[model samples]
Target: MPDLRKEIINILDGKLLTPHFQPIVSLTHKKILGYEALIRGPSNSPLHSPFNLFTTAERFNLSTKLEFLCREITIQRYADLDIKEKLFINASPLVLLQPEFKKGETLRLLDQYGVNPRSVVIELTEHKPADNYEIMRASAKHYRGMGFEIALDDLGAGYSGLRLWAELLPEYVKIDKHFVHSLHNDPIKLNFVRSIQSMAVSLNCSVIAEGIETQEEFKAIEKIGITNAQGYYFARPTAVPVKEIDKALFAIEQDTDCKSAPFNNATTAVQIIRDITPISAKTTISDVMNLFHHNSELTILPLVDDNIASGIIFRDKFLTKLFSSRYGIDLHGKNPIKMFIENTPLCIDKNMPIDLVSKQLTSLMTNDPAFIITHNGEYMGVGTLLDLLAEFTRQQIDNAKHANPLTLLPGSVPINNQINQLLANKIPFGFGYFDLDNFKPFNDVYSYDAGDAIIKAVANTLIQYIPAESGRVGHIGGDDFIVIFTCDDWLTRCKNILKAFESTVPSHYSDKDINAGGIHTENRAGEKCFFPLISLSVGLVDPVSTSQCQSHVDIADLASEAKKMAKKIPGNSLFINQRMAAKNSGNFQSFTHSATKLHIVN
Candidate 1:
């Protein structure tokens, strides 16, 4: 311990700190959003680990000095490397509050290195519990005021992390690795992440999942819509990091995961673009008024700079402001159009799903019926609410034509279309065909209404259990449902659904039936017999690629056959037919499950 302490002191004295950078990637844009600077001591020394180095510094009452040195080294190294992305430097709250810590030291270092303060994020990495929330909050606010964004690091790994988050209101919060490891298989972890994501959305803050080490974990994080993530899965922390993201890390021709709108994968913002000519920001308001007068149908004048949309101008609002008073037009006529522009107008990519576009447009809550459309961030055209509503309604009506009336889930047509879309994209997925075991016997015992209740219950369970990002739930008429899974842990989600069904389905039964564990009903031959409780049977098939299945028809046939195999196992069962195995042998090596036992069928 004494030796480590001396080493840390000597290292700090010599300013021997190494800054390793890891890229934080934006899943939506498929680009490197920024890089977080991680510090290390001499590699061959005992204080090489950050934990050992920092703890030793803290133990020797040199934490403030060590932290300042780390920040200076990180900023200088990051600038020296000519990294274009934002740099995140770790700072301790305790050190920030210490009397020795200067207020503008970080800003000074950034200036000396010729780096913008706005491009730096001061990540609060708590080494100890902050007893004074007021000072910590004020310190964080001070950093923000200096144009440095704050990020709360290792959330859920330290004391009062949530409280600190509430106080600091960081622009970014990173989830600890505990929640990210094996996230694909653990529903609990997935739920935790989803809840955090929900909070991040409401607060308008971004989330970064740290310590991701596998593709499954990355996929789960991406599916949950976390804005940015950094871990060894993309690249390990190093002195020099890769600038651009590898094309192989993500699918180049991936389809947006449309949970609510099944057919939205086909319709995009480009389809509804109105192709209205845009005016430059430097154009005078007087010129815009003349243009609007000349074009009677033009209610919106999109403002563009360098072919990138800057804002929008509504004719009614612009005219109202100009004519509300006698001096309005004379006072503002010569002003640039940018003065009247609403800078927060909804600007979305041309390929964004129409449903998602509609949601964003509605969120603006503006009476102005127009939004700016961009293709790869360049102005493409303008879209109006009328066109969006018309197209959305048309698709909804078309969807309803093939939707199940009872459950309102997608029927055969949309389901088939979704399957083909997945296949066309060559995205590997799994399909589970769900069928009610002994459903007809339940209909015999209970009336048709009770039977319908059971079917609806199954549909609701599927919706509740299957996450929309991981899979799409569709009702294929009565007593039949299907799921197309894009997540790697499809079987885990399927088992969770089975467990949930087993637990909840008993509520629909009477006390007598519950006690007896069976219902007295007439058989197919019209003879009296005892029937067991209604349960679910799910057949799972993992199609690796397009070569295994040419079309949705082949997928349906394979899924249907797997369902039959699952049904053979009695109640509340799941059967997985290895499609990859079948690709070679022309036969299935099946793994079937009963309520409490596993069966291997070769």
Candidate 2:
């Protein structure tokens, strides 16, 4: 035991660990979100994996020492790369507290590495429940107060991880690979992940899936609507992490966390706020002109009436009027600028959606100019027409570029974003998953082009039956579609979608098949069989009146279960899981989430 303890001390006292890094890619941004700092024991040693290294430390009573060494070396190497991205370092409270840290040595090392406290995320790293919640929470707050963020590591794999989440309220949570591994096909693992993701949304926590090693898993995670991912599928951990991921697989879109940037009622309001100070309405016209001349970048000088923006003074128009007659400034220079204060200022709520703002702009005069953004009837800032155009452009790029080429509907990227928004805001909605029964048979005989047309027809029908302003329609690749609807009449609308698609889609089939009832086609196993003409199977996932229906994964799964049930009915059918709305839940944690409580409809 003494010899083992000596070796543990030696490892911590010496350079026995190699610093490896892994890139955490943002699923929505298609960019490197950050690199997680991972430690490796010496090659060709029993301590190669971090698990073995830490376990040995725990056995040797040197866990704290080993943890410190890992953090020190990881921070120094991260600074060596001069990586500007956030660094996620694994740590536990016990590992961080020691006689040395009392002197703020960890913070000193961060300074030596030139790592910003803001950019350093200390992931509460452990596989078991924390021994002391008060101690761990205090440690988390201590680091947070120093501008470091707290992240829960290996969330689902840890005991009491949910309790830690509720108590600590970390900014990020990383799902353990055990749950993410082959999650594409594993219903149980998928359910675990979906529950974590849904609960994370309610807490305003960003979730990153770890150990994603396959494309199928990545696609599944995307479909579940998690915004961040880190695993070998993107890149294996390396000493020097690659800053630019040049692969198309990494081309994720930008993340819009609606928790902070809220858009109510599905409308996007682009908040155009500048940090510029304001001028009062009684300021002399001379003072206004001079202030404008001094700060050339100031486009709109707002006139405040008791802190509320009562009017605005346009920079260009103000200057033009001043020099219009050469002696104009002298004529009105000393006069209070009330004469120049706009009579009808352009003002819109800060929470208004961008599309709604665009419509409001179009209805006004063509020369309406810039509008002030107000919150609670008080001006917060000003927005120009250019800002509106830019926001629209960004949304277009996010939607049109990544959209499904066949159905011309939003593909997985936008679909995930929409789901994330709903989850972030805790908005209750219904998810309808539509699948064509016997679609492969039609595709085999009528050709892929005809199958594509059927998908389009279904997409159009879903869109036609569902309202534009209140729902999101998505194509989850071939033969599958997702719709998230937020109307009180969602159940009726879902029935209409099934009725419309099943009734109209039959015409797309050939006369021989239509009359014969089905076409002969080989199954996936190549066994010849009679495949019925295409029919719609719609699965509906209704949200509880409570926000307990947390994750898109649950809704997606419920929709899946519903769809599976519908498909069993032998024709175009709609199915609802009777127990879903009441039984399915994230109830602070999942053991309480039970399928037995679910109401299943035949």
Candidate 3:
């Protein structure tokens, strides 16, 4: 014990703490959101492990001093390295309330190190139960008042996770590593995370999934719609963490997964972002009043903390309350704007579908009719309900015009629009052409009504099986459909659709034909032959680079050729086009129409 105390003292006096950084990445944007500043003792010391170092310090009643040293070192090193993203520094509640903890000590350190308070998130770590909620709340607010965001770290591992969350209302909550490890295979764990995500959404906060160490775990989190994540899967803690995401990881995210599946050409909140400058929560209310007086057109004031949209202040509401009492302005004008800010204001991610945003706005009973727009939980701009309605209505009218009357799915025109958009954006995606086999014979036997049902069934299967965020389904008339898949597991989705179609087709057939395994029908040559039951054939074209294909026309030609290949098979089949690969290998040229048209307009 004496030896440990001496080592601790020497370490503190010598300032020998090493600050290592681990990246916190955004799965949605495929970029580094920030880094958590983790402290380590000397490599050869017995107190090398953070847990042992901190526990021994606590045992010797030097916790506050040690924690302060860690903070100073972290802030200084973070600025020295010139990292651009936010820096998360862990702060225990006990250290925060200690008598020796100076009121402006952290602020002084930040200013000395040239680190912006807005780029730092004070991650509250509960080394033990924190029974004093009021003091903890006050401490958290102090940091928040300085433009720093608060985050509850290792949520489930703490003794009073929900209580602390409710008391402090942190801007971010990190799900404990225990809940995220092997999350893909554990249904209960997944459910816990989903519930946490749902709660965060409702509370207008962000959830960061921690300790994701495997690809399957990340895929599961992506599917669950969690945006920010931290784990070894991305990178481990080091003196100098990776500044840019790995290209392979970026490709995996882009080609296979989306936190929120946005259809090709889908309108998102970003389209309606109004260029509005946000105010820091620490801005004086009098300053806000002066601005409102100067700009009559401005109606809403967005409150941002550490780049996160924390709340909003309505121009009219704030003014009315201030003057409702004679001494209101005199009493509250000097107070920070956050004291009167609307904590529950609507905040929408920029990538959210406009239709969904419209739905959210309409469901709310608030009369302000405004929302703050964010990108990966960072403030981007503000949007109003009026603009959202206009955009959503435009989309609806446009979709209705190009929709197939039979299936109400996107028809040829919209299909072309989607394809053109994908090509223009240079987004990598698989294209699948769907066609029904033995359809003409089925129409002959069952009539147009039954044939329509069959076509609708195929459309339903495609829509049901394909994930909406990564794939878009379209009807190209009759039994022909098209699916554009940005998800990596497109082949699996296609096979599932085939299996579903096979299961349902038998019910559409009579028992005698079912027993016969087919129907004896007249062939195109007028000869009687056995026609098998209607089956689906899917031809998939792997993601082709924009350099290889000029437009949707080129893709259509390649996919159509693949569809023909699939049709030649005996039964339901999926044929993947490898022309792109073969062409790259110098075995084949680019696929194009066989004959050129000679214009003969009369």
Report the candidate with higher TM-score, 1 versus 3. 3
TM-score of each: 0.57, 0.52, 0.62
Kindly list the per-residue Cα lDDT of model 3 for residues 1-602, writing each as its tens digit: 34998999899899988999999996545579999989899999998889889988988888989988999999888888999999998887777667788778899999999999999999986747655776668769888988899999998997888888877889899999999999889989988988888778656577898998988888778656676899898999999878987846634532332233245446778899998888988899899999999999989888876676656788888888789864287888898886664334555777677876766566544566687786655679999978988888898899998889999988777667766766666667888899999999988888899999999899888888885676889998888999888788887787777777888898888999989988888889998888988888777788753226777788888788878977877567777776875775533212211123112111
- Root-mean-square deviation of every model: 10.2, 21.3, 9.2
Whole-model lDDT per candidate:
0.79, 0.73, 0.79
Say which prediction, candidate 1 or candidate 2, comes out ahead on TM-score: 1
Query: Candidate 2: lDDT of 508?
Result: 89
Model 1 scores worst on lDDT over the 10 consecutive residues at 252-261
Instruction: Tally clashing residue pairs in candidate 1.
Output: 0
TM-score of 2: 0.52
Candidates by TM-score, descending order: 3, 1, 2
Q: Candidate 1 lDDT, tens digit per residue, 126-221?
A: 646656677668768888989989999998898788788877889899999999999999999999998888777556578999989988898778
